[model samples]
Target chain A: MASEIVVDKLVKRFGHATAVDAISFSVDQRETVGLLGPNGAGKTTTMRILAGLSPADGGTVQLAGLDARTQGREVRRLLGVVTQQDGLDVEISVRENLTVYGYLCGLSRQASATRADAVLTFFGLEGRANDEVDALSGGMKRRLAIARAWMTRPRIIILDEPSTGLDPHSRARVWENLAELKAGGVTVLMSTHYMEEAAVLCDRVAIMDRGRILALGPPRALIAEHAGRGAIEIRCDEAQRDAVRAALTAIAVPWREMGAVFSLPDEGADLGPVATLAGVQVHHRPAHLEDVFLRLTGKELVDD
Target chain B: MTEFRLRSVAGVVERHRVATVRTWKVALTWFLIEPAFVLVAMGSGVGQLVVEIPGHGPYSHFVTPGIIIGMVMFHALFDSAWGVFNRIQQGAFETQLTAPVTVTELAAGEALWGGIRGVISTLAIGGLAILLGWFPLSALPVTLLVSFVVGVQFGVVGLCSASASPSMSALTLVFTVMATPLFFFSGSFFPLEVLPDWVEPLAWIAPLTPGVHLARGLAEHSLDLSHALCALYLVAFTLLLFPVAARMLRARLVK
Candidate 1:
């Protein structure tokens, strides 16, 4: 499939701090890609540039085959962007929100009303159609925000932290909605910090930090390449730390430290020497993107 | 060749309409109570102390037009400046800009809504004036037209102010410094000729002065070359400020 969104050598700067350093990536039509990173990791900045809400300091973005810079009006018509803030008019009804966006996209009065109803039903917001946005729970408001974006029938949607601040059930519902969108073949480029969300929802994931893509590929492939088959976690006392480090180095295995716990890639290596250390506990578990992120940055994924 | 989109402008207006309608009890109460209280208290209560004025027959007649124009300017300025500032802070325009709407359209829609609000205020206060026999029923059409012009004028001013204001307190300060002076000095409740010679020039230059003059002339059946000039002044002010307001909002919103 042709690339639906292509970003090349994108750079964004805010005074002395670079928000999005020179980076390049693309999302093909009907494919979902996630930009996974911690806070201030340039994900929102990148999504904003692609949505045409902010200017890029350098480089280019193409959405649905239209240049985001030169053909912004055309590009915007094919794009639906949900920023981190839901940005709903809390004073209005849930249905009115969708209709307003429909009209903004140049739908006729009758068409906008029809589309509003359609999207409300599709997003399971029809039951709350007449309710004021302020009266709804946080999850309903987020769903309405997405439904409003979908009202324009956009070919591609850009969401920044779509499921942030939601309970597990609400997050699952949002995920199911997104999965349906993907099933219907809408291209999606989303930014998220949740490892499980990216792992489950995205066809490919780009791990980013400090304005750079640290790694980009399928989730399983990235795990295999960076974290190996599993992770061996060893918790030891401060006194034995030096000896434990020496024992692991003598065996030549890659490892990362988090407080008293040392996590090493569970390659089938001899670990009897390290296991025999005094006052040390050892265990093993399946590898995940958290381990990959830790292995790549030597920093905890949830730190930032 | 034009970037202006009428549909987008209409969309924004519709949103504002829906918002106003949803809180119609509050709006209706404002429409009936605020203007009626101001007009009756100033027209009857204060008019008794003054009795009459030269060139215009009664104090009631002289002040009615002033009150109508004042109400129009007040509604337009409040809805555009303060309302726009609140919406910007809430990131409302960010959602609209993601669609096929342009910044120019958004500005135009806001100005148009301001005009609508001005018209509503005018009808309320002008209706009270007609019932009280302070204004002629024949002048309603021209009065509404003038109200719309003045509304557009102040709407642009409000947009410019909101775009430049850095914080809510800063916006309040701007309004206190700018709007309060304009309201008091624009010949709204009294003639500029009675003020000190130095203050007269300053009062005449207040942006609301032209709208007051034109509205008063139409309501009193005293239209002249000066009234035409007042209309021209209002039109020129709107034309000059509209693009500046749009550009300022674009700078703040699209960054």
Candidate 2:
């Protein structure tokens, strides 16, 4: 499939600090790609450049085969961007917000109205069309933001942390809407901190750290490559650490320590000896994207 | 390969129109009542105390044009500075930027909207002047045209300031140190000739002075060479500042 988006060695700098280093990636048509990273990992900067909201300091971006640097207006026309910040016009009605954005996207007044209605219904916000956006709940506002982006019927949608602050139910609703978009074969590029969200929604996940992509692949593929099928976790205090390490070494299993817990690959390795060790608890489960992320980016908390 | 469209500006102007309509009560207070109060207090009350000026006829007539120009200046300044700043902070411009709208289009639309508003407010004060028979009816169109030019000029200036302002309080400093001082010293109330020798150069450099000169000349139907030069200076200044304003706003917004 032809790539709908291509970013080559994208770089962004804020004064002396480089926000996005020489990072490159692509999204195929009808494919969903996730930029998975912690805060200040340059995910938002990359998305902003792809969405034509910011300029790249070095490298090039192509959207639907058009150069983003020189053809920003055209790139924007083909993209529907939902930024991390809610961009809804609080002074306007929910429907009006979408309609006005549609008009800005070059739709006629009549077409804008129709598109607004369709998006409102799509986001399950038809009943609140006439209500002021400021009066809507946070979740509803997010839905409105997405619906407004959808109003343009863009071929590619870029969402920056689409479900960052939503509750479980609202996040589920957002996922359902995104799922619908996926079912309709819309190209999606999203940045997320939620490992589950990326695992569920992304066809390919690009794990990012600092200002570069550390790994990129399918969720299952990354887990298998970086974390194996499953892991045996041994939790023990400092006093019991030596006993646990000796037990794992005697069993000939490779183990890595993260804080108070030690993780070993679950390659049919006998954990009976480690489990039998006193003052240590064992947990065995399938490896997940979170584990891969932790392995790639370390367990230290990324300061916002 | 992508073709840029020109229709995006109408969308931005429409959005501003809708927002203005939604807040018509506040808009009316600023566009109409505030100017009326200034006209009454300065043109009428202050007019009563001052005797007849040398070149200008009556106090009320001499200051009427100044008050009208001040209205346009204030409206354009506030709309482009505080209004643009608030919209930027609220991500309003970002939302539009995400669409097919270019930064130049956004800046032009804002400047045009400010001019339209200045014209509307000018009409309000012009109507009052006509009702009271304070100025000649023949110069109404010219006065309004001058008011629009002043609007665009100051609108661009305001956007330039807004682009550099880091916070709302920083904008307060702009209003205090820049706008307030310009408002008082720009020959809006009395002639610049009455000021001290050192202040004459400052008044000459004030952005509002040429606008005041053109407005007063057109209002009184006394378009002399100096007033004509002032009008030319305003036209040249607007043409120069508009692109600068657009570039500055683009830098601040596109990041």
Candidate 3:
């Protein structure tokens, strides 16, 4: 399949500090790729450059085979962007917001209205279509924001933190909407801190930090590579923590400390030695994208 | 590309139209009722004291055109400055930029909206003036055209100021410093000749001076070389400041 989005060595700088430092990635047609990182990791900056909201100091971004820097209008025509902030027209009704945005996307009066209704229905906002945006809940506003993006019928959609700051129920609803879009073969590029959101929604995940992508691959593949099949979590006190660490190091297994617990990458290594240690509680769980992210960034993915 | 640019501008204007329509009650109060109050309190009340001005027949008639054009300036200024500033704070500019709307096109749309609003206020206030027998119905078309052009000029000026203003308080400060002087110094209430000679020449420096000159000439049915020059000045002013305003807003937003 052809690449719908290609970012090559994209660089953006604010004065002397580089926000996006020579990062490169691509998303194939109909693929969903998530940029997973902590705050100040350049994900939002990179996405803004792609969406034509900001200029890049270096590198090229191509969307749907058009150069983003030179052919910005064409690139924008092909891509819909949802910034981290809810940019919906709060004074208008949900349906009016979508309709007005459709007009902005160059839809005709009739076509804009038609597409607005369809998008509202698709995003499950048809019920409150006439209600003013300020009257809607935060989750409803978010859904409306995403629905506005679909008004253009864009081939590729770039969303910055698509489901951030939502209740679990609302987040799940947003995920369901996005999943439905992904199922329909739309290419999606998103930045998110939620490991589960990335693992569940993205076809491939890029772990980013300090303006660089440390690892990029399918979520499961990244977990298997960075964190073996599963990891052994040993909860121990101060003395036992050192002993557990020394035991894992003695066996040549890599380990990381998480407060009172020591996480040892279980490469089928002899866990019997660590488990036999006194005054320590041990538990083993399957590897996950969080482990991969923590191992790559060397820091916990705390909420921003 | 030009066609698409036009479409983008139309979209933005349409959004503004819908928003304005939604709050038309407030718009009516600003455009119609406020002008009437100003005319009653300032025009008729003040006109009663002044037996006659030299050239103009009545004090009310002398200030009628000034008031109409002043409304245009006021609408253009407030809409482009405060309205665009509010939209920027609300993130609507970012939202529009994400679409196919270019920065220049967005600026054009905003400036054009200011002009349209100016025309609306012109019609509102001018219509009331006609109903009260203070303005001529025959001059409505020319007054509307002049108001639209002046609107666009003030719009660009407002946009530039808005781009530089860092906060709402700062913007209000700028407005108080800038617009208040123009409001009084521009011959809106009295002729510039009435000021001290040194101050009279300085009053001509304000942009609204030419607007008042042209509007007074038009309203009094006394067209002359100065009115024609004022028209040219307004157009030139709009053309010169528009790109500057667009560039400033682009710098502020695209950063």
Candidate 3: the clashing residue pairs are none
Q: Across residues B1-255, which tens digit of lDDT does each residue of candidate 2 receive?
A: 433345877888888787788789998898888888888887779888996778898888888888788888888888899988888888878998998888888888888777887898889887887777776777789888988998888888888988989999989877889878888888888999999999898898688899888888887777779987888888899899988998999889888
lDDT of 1: 0.87
Q: What is the lDDT of residue B181 in candidate 1?
A: 76
Query: How many residue pairs in model 2 have overlapping backbones?
Result: 0
lDDT for A120 in candidate 3 is 92
Q: Candidate 1 on A1-304: residue-level lDDT in tens?
A: 8999999999999888999999999999999999998898899999999988889999999887788987888998898889889988766788988887787788988999998999999999899999988898888888888898898878999999989999999999999999999899999999999999999899999999899999999999999998777899999999999989999999987777788888887778898999999999899988988888877776666655
Candidate 2, clashing residue pairs?
none
| Deviation (Å) of A121 in candidate 3 | 1.1
For candidate 3, report its TM-score: 0.93
Report lDDT (Cα) of residue B202, candidate 2: 81
> lDDT, candidate 2, residue B198?
93
Per-residue accuracy of model 3 over A137-171 as CA lDDT, tens digit each = 88988899999998988899999999999999999
iRMSD values, candidates in order: 1.0, 1.0, 0.9
Cα lDDT of all candidates, in order? 0.87, 0.86, 0.87
By lDDT, the best candidate is 1
Off by over 4 Å in 3: A234-280, B1-4
